[model samples]
Target chain A: MQGRTRNIYLIPYMLWIVLFVVAPIALIMYYSMFNIDGAWSLENYRRFFTPVYLSMTLRSFWYAILITGFALLIAYPTAYLLTKTEHKQLWLMLIILPSWINLLLKVYAFIGILGFYGPINSFLRIIGIGSRQILFTGFSFIFVAVYIFIPYMILPVFNALEELNPSLVDAARDLGASPWATFRRVIFPLTVSGVKAGCRAVFIPALSLFMITRLIAGNRVITLGTAIEQHFLVTQDWGMGSTIAVFLIIAMGLTMIMTENGKLVK
Target chain B: MKKVMQMFITVVIAALGLMYLTFVLNSQQGYSGGNTLTVYNWGDYIDPELITKFQQETGIKIIYQTFDSNEAMLTKIAQGGTSFDVAIPSDYAISKMKEQGLLIPLDHCKIPNLKYIDPRFLDLPFDENNEYSAPYFWGTLGIIYNPEILEGMEFTSWNDLWDERLRNEILLYDSAREVIGMGLNSLHYSLNDTDIDHLMEAKRKLDALSPNIKAIVGDEVKMLLANEEAAIGVVWSGDASEIIGANDKLDYVIPDEGTNIWFDNIVIPAGAKNVEGAHLFINFMLDPENAAQNTEYVGYSTPNMKALEYLPEEITGDVRFYPGSDITDKFELYENLGKKMTAYYNELFLEFKMHRK
Candidate 1:
């Protein structure tokens, strides 16, 4: 009876996934297999593997990894602090505030913070420091991606920390393990699933990030999302667009599978 | 009392769910009608008062929407979910829409001020005789540079895009065609080059110039130039005006390679429900006074010659808007590159973007 009730409770969520996520992804697959110009062809796939696009795919991958790595480094400390904080709710709200703003607005706001005449430069002038050319480089893109995704990393990790067996840490200390060893041996393994989940959340979006990078990095940076967007909109070639999209989906799929398997191992 | 509170909670939850359902369904379905005339155009492209004036005149409310790029505007139309009565698309997009049967051709007889448009803008590459599109505003793509930073430097050609002196001080527009087309024009090739070798040449030129480029900007190009984040940039004539308005030190120059002169026009979609209304709106906008108001607001050259008479001498006399006959005569209007060529151009653009240093 309890098993039947649990299945009943899942019905709405299952229907939602079917209608929204599953359907759109399935459509993408169907579209990817056919030529968008009212025919069937694999030319889109053939063209994708060329040196130019392959390099872009690799560049985008590394950029995303770097962004996710930075986000993890920043968020883990903050999430851990929040877990220990008395004002946990307030701190969480502060961490999540920027995520509530439109993504584009936050990016443009970065221009005011990082641009040539922005506050950073003006402050530098006051202190007789550096110049104003730091805002449009590839580094700026990664910074913006990490800023936007930090909360995504923080939330999962924070939840994992919140649910941790705190007494296990105490018992490890009682058995004479150092703080670092206790965390590595006890806390880290328990939180690995959340870290994996957080990494996926941050990395997937960061990998395909386009508008913010385009806006903030000033088009000096290119990612797979921008390439697909150009094919679909500028070229009006849905075949090529769908093909690039398929590759992005596949790359993301492999990453998710690896992360999930890692979580299972934990 | 407990039952009453539970009923109240149930009612509130149901209401919230209904609201979410409505929002989701509405996005899928599209804008519903209620005396609203949806006008979609480039961002900051027109005066709000013009919309108000039209609404007051026609008793039909205006639903104004703006897009940042020509491609974005086209995507919205192609989505086939939204119904916009009036859209202002650039010359090439006008051609593409007409070819795709996405537009309803205008009955020239209905638009009286159509005569006010200079004959030069009428029989253009995209829509000859203004059949499917009415010339709303026109301008060229060129460099807007700060004289203070440029010092004694003079930019006379598209080759100026590669001037090493301006390295890391220059900004380029993010639009693919504008960037690639300038490169093509510099090489004495058509902006719509389909030849692989010509494209390769454009690519090589862009790649070499990429290091000098600080950013590929869009709407923020004006702000960047004004703030001195960039000393020089490729910009539309209208944006050049906005930057110049902000600072007296800026000047827009039409490259000697013959900059692209384009007209963004008002057109009715083939899927339009109110063709007559759209025609009326176009006619209303084309009236000399209304056209002048829009021109003043957007800071672009109006196609209507009669409207030019009402515009301030500073606006009408600006060299960028009313260029010398030599430059004006040399301007190229972008025409639609049919399907295959468009795909080829897109691929080249993608390749350039991917290989960026």
Candidate 2:
């Protein structure tokens, strides 16, 4: 296969990305630079310099980090445990079965689980502890976000763990390394790629959580996605909405660059 | 959703419209997609059986779509090239569409059933003389509260929402206008007032009320209230009716400080292909029985005077559905403040959302 003939297969997928992704992004760029009347301006971006709006953009980044960190903490162990399980495929299936449910439905279910009269609160009442407001707090926001995206973290880490060389761990243990030291020295160092990949998978979606933020997080979590929605859908300010969307896209790109840099460091 | 570049969708829709036009004209006579009407409306706003009946009577196929909000509907039609014959948009949106040239002047002469609509809703600020739109459903914002939770503290004023005694027990409407408008109403300022000091006053009230609110929410407020997770909430009349039905302990009240009255109106977009079909559809929807059916199904108050006779006594007699003139006389309909004021209000709202304690 000559270079041109071999590259023919890439054409279809390249066209798909260009049409669906690149062109739409180009349009957003166009919109971010103009108003509804088609006047060329940076007025939309200028509006975000206010402290309140600026904080929302920053808070969204903080939330993405929080969700990614939490997902890693929980999913790393869950995935590692899955690696030790007898029916690995069946266990993985159970892990992914919830994700297959509708995202909105899942968020609604979280509301039921975390509400004042919910099972958690009922259990608390039974234990002689008073019922507390749990559903609309910042804690519940991250919990649901972590709940929704943890599987993304788990799958990649699981694959990476499954690919671990057994000889390396045995060699570390034979050299008088304790269980923790053997795992840290041999297993952890090699799975950096998977952790990085999982962060990539989890971070971007978590950054743009609009619906779940409203349902689970309540008014407490005003993210960049919420700001964009207010402008575009509620206020009918498309230019402003596009500006926030452009900011979001750039923020995600920067994250990707940072993740790639981490890979380069090793 | 990030890829939904609303600004550039106009061009794409124009191109699609051209292709659609070609397809429509190329087919055989009488079978050439000539008798089809396209409608865009709020989800569950109308009685579906009426649509079926309209199609059966007129022999016109109906293609219907539903939008969740006025802005969403406006964005779709604003993209242009849509052949949507009819759309139901809120009042402020009608003003915006009229200013944007997105709507055509409705032919009142063709719509004889417009006579059946109440005089109160006609010749309003959004559409003077009802030129571009007809009233569909109108409702007011009110406090829906559980009496047992509030310990029989009769709630009547906007300040009641800010009551510190109700800390973390209040559920505020997630809407920028309605939430902030309630504050404006508390201070006796117009909800559409553009004065910086007045808006700042409302902001201060909201900032003060911040500690008391459990959440700022939309439709989810109903379920939360029904579950007794929230003691009180700001909700529209229709939602209040349904939720009150579910939980008998909950009751709806329009505060003495006054609140917003909104209208979901039916209009024909400028580029509609079947203007006659649009008029016919509007007329059919306005038929007293059809309008009554819609009110019953959607649980929103109808603006059609003739329709009131057909509605059940329990629904028509519900004070929330049709509050007394003394209370309703003070209700303010939302005005279209255009771009600059809307931006300011939106900014104020974002600041309120960011308010801590």
Number of the predicted model whose TM-score against the real structure is largest: 2
DockQ of 1: 0.44
| Predicted candidate 1, C-alpha RMSD | 5.1
iRMSD, model 1, in Å: 4.0
Candidate 1 runs further than 4 Å off: A1-14, A262-266, B1-40, B50-85, B271-277
lDDT of 2 by residue, A1-102 (tens): 478665865877999999999999999999889875558998777876767768888898899999999999999999999999999999999998999999
* Residue B291, model 2, lDDT: 94
Each model's Cα RMSD: 5.1, 5.5
lDDT of 1 by residue, B1-357 (tens): 456579889999999999999878765654345455777887878888988888779877667888877778777888878788889998888887877788887888888879898888887778877778998888899988888878878888888768778778878776777888988999989876778899889888888887788887777888888988788988888788888889979888988778788888899876666677788889998999999988888777888889989999988887777886677888887767667876777667666765556
| Model 1 per-residue lDDT tens digits across residues A149-258 | 99999999999989888998899999999999988998888898889999999999888887876788877778888887777767777777788888999999999999
Q: What C-alpha lDDT does candidate 1 achieve relative to the native structure?
A: 0.83
lDDT, candidate 1, at B221:
85
